[model samples]
Target: MAIPGYDSGNVAEFALERAGARAEVVAGVVPDEFGLERSGRDPTATALADAVEFVGLEELRAVDAFRIELVYDPSALPPGASPTDVGIAVETDDGWERLESTVDLEATTVSATLGGRPSGSTIVAIYDGTGES
Candidate 1:
């Protein structure tokens, strides 16, 4: 399913592999204040694009597996940050957890797979800098 990014002109894609799983997915760009506040929680990382929230993800907890892909603007990245430095971070009960993702620089997309569901908000974050957090 393709979730519109509202005015951001970006589209968040979701795919469920379970045979009988359904969810109402809603997504949008995270507000600047919120993104800025949360994006810098890791000292070595900085947000390169607007964070995106995937609403109604609680239903996905029952699924066996799922994948989420987020679109980000390369132009929004800070100086010295390359596409290879991009990765996906998901909000969880513990904190923001960075997930292993496959990035397509040409497509400006980052994808990650989850075995179950996140405990907190589901947000797509692009962090740049040192070690993964």
Candidate 2:
């Protein structure tokens, strides 16, 4: 299995929102492993209990993929929203636009296959609902 980890979104941004702290996010592919790994770590927890990771995607196509891990935190969620309501958005030359993707509550992450080759400079916004900011 030639599963390659795709560079998709900002790890810091995703971890901050999930951990609600200046947490650490681990990204990149594992050596000799065919899968993408992402995690949001809370130092206070000091373990994977409060952390979130997404793995085992078949492949990455055009565009980019983001694994947003939003733990069950009432404060992190806006009114009328739940952890499962997490959404994905991307910033293009036109402006901030909505990108369709899949969300896995079990994994506590949202994954998207975008249509452009996003570099480190690409801006990816993971927000709640289809709201405009």
Candidate 3:
């Protein structure tokens, strides 16, 4: 599925595999700035783009896994932050959880394969000078 950006002209694509039931997915980009708090583990973590929301994911049951890919503009990143420093984060009950994701520098995209279906908001995050890139 291709999710169009609300105003940034960016697009996010996702794929659900091994879903137990049919899903009624509605996805869109939240063009507003997202203020992500700094964590002890990643004090320099910052939001690189607007939030992406995936609604109706609750309709999917017993899904094995899903993959999401977000495209972002390079200009949106802070100075000295490369695309390699970018990762995917999902809003959880506790807080925003960063997912293990891979960055395609050539495509300006970051992707992650999440185990099971996640019903919440997601965003592109960058950990400045963390060397995770």
Candidate 4:
């Protein structure tokens, strides 16, 4: 939902899109620093931090024969014209860690690649929420 050219109200709307890549975006958390402020008039103002991180992942596995393709519309989900960092959790026999790769956000979609993720059984998840990105 969080398209490069769009900025909604929620940070989860942001997605990590790539090509020829297999992976899932997990734990996406955008901690916007919110603080109370006092001015000459209104004493109820808050500051927000503009940062991006993984909050959730569709989930993937080479053992479960699981693969998916993420294709959804990022229409006004996270209304912003900036690219966000995508984090992922790769499931393996040795527990899990952070997945390192490139996630490019196109004009209409997002894609990702995870260590040359399994072919054929590719899984793609697109933003399908009616909210803004």
Candidate 5:
């Protein structure tokens, strides 16, 4: 099966693998920004575009529930910015809801559990206290 409008090279391949399906690129590519690059100098180099569109991955839709995990490096954040300063919001039929979060600074990840979400709810994560978005 061929999927249209996805990255042509590694991104599509990776999405296919993650989807656990065999799919070919039928049209348009997923673009380089969607793929990871190890340029020798930066072995951990990865660029996740601000947004990505995935098609034909019904398996992903099977997720009954999910947790939002925001990972950040303390050193990368502005001085004096605490991990608790961040928060996540999920779009509901009525409006946005703030999720109760757990902060794990050692792991540099903040997690918030969101029960089952609507099919196409937008999740917005922001620096709630004081910092950049």
Candidate 6:
């Protein structure tokens, strides 16, 4: 079995939110799991901890195993939200939407905001298009 690592939500959930399909979500990052953000919540922190990866299934000799890692910015959460149980949201063409009921998160991280309550991370959204960016 192939191995994988992540800091947040899993693959199936993330994809469904993106594709507007159906999926189920669980908690914690499993050793072998992928990740996704349903693009929901008014001020969620899934963006920082969010990550997406796609390897040509054909390259692994038709292997069906994959992995995803998440690392979210804790500040994005509400004032009294629980850091342990993180929520996910997806942004679509129309507007911010919620992933199906099956969506869930994997791992999480929280850091004190600089003279502020809490804010979402800009690492993913402002990526410079380095292809790797």
lDDT of 1 by residue, 20-56 (tens): 1122222343222221122223322454544555445
Q: Write the per-residue lDDT of candidate 6 for residues 61-126, one digit (tens) a residue.
A: 222223222345556654665544432333444543332111123334221111211122111221
TM-score of 2: 0.37
Query: Model 2 Cα displacement at 69 (Å)?
Result: 8.1
Instruction: Tell me the spans in candidate 4 whose CA falls farther than 4 Å from its real position.
Output: 1-69, 81-104, 116-133
lDDT of 6 at 115: 21
CA lDDT for candidate 6: 0.30
Where model 3 places Cα greater than 4 Å from the true spot, the runs are: 1-45, 125-129
- Over all chains combined, what TM-score does candidate 4 have? 0.23
- Against the correct fold, how does model 3 do in TM-score? 0.59
lDDT assessment of candidate 1 = 0.50
Range of the 10 consecutive residues with the lowest summed lDDT in candidate 3: 17-26
Location of the lowest summed lDDT over 10 successive residues in candidate 1: 17-26
Q: Give the TM-score of candidate 1.
A: 0.57
Please report the TM-score between candidate 5 and the true structure.
Answer: 0.39
Q: TM-score of every model?
A: 0.57, 0.37, 0.59, 0.23, 0.39, 0.28
Q: Write the per-residue lDDT of candidate 2 for residues 2-115, one digit (tens) a residue.
A: 112632243322234434211122234322222322343221221212432323322223223333323333345556765445544433456444445455666555444433
Candidate 4 vs candidate 6, TM-score winner: 6
CA lDDT scores, all candidates in order = 0.50, 0.35, 0.51, 0.28, 0.37, 0.30
Clashes of each: 0, 2, 0, 48, 6, 26
Arrange candidates by lDDT, highest first: which order?
3, 1, 5, 2, 6, 4
TM-score of decoy 6: 0.28
lDDT string for model 3 (63-96, tens) is 4445666665678777776668777776776767
Choose the strongest candidate by TM-score: 3
Better of 1 and 2 by lDDT: 1
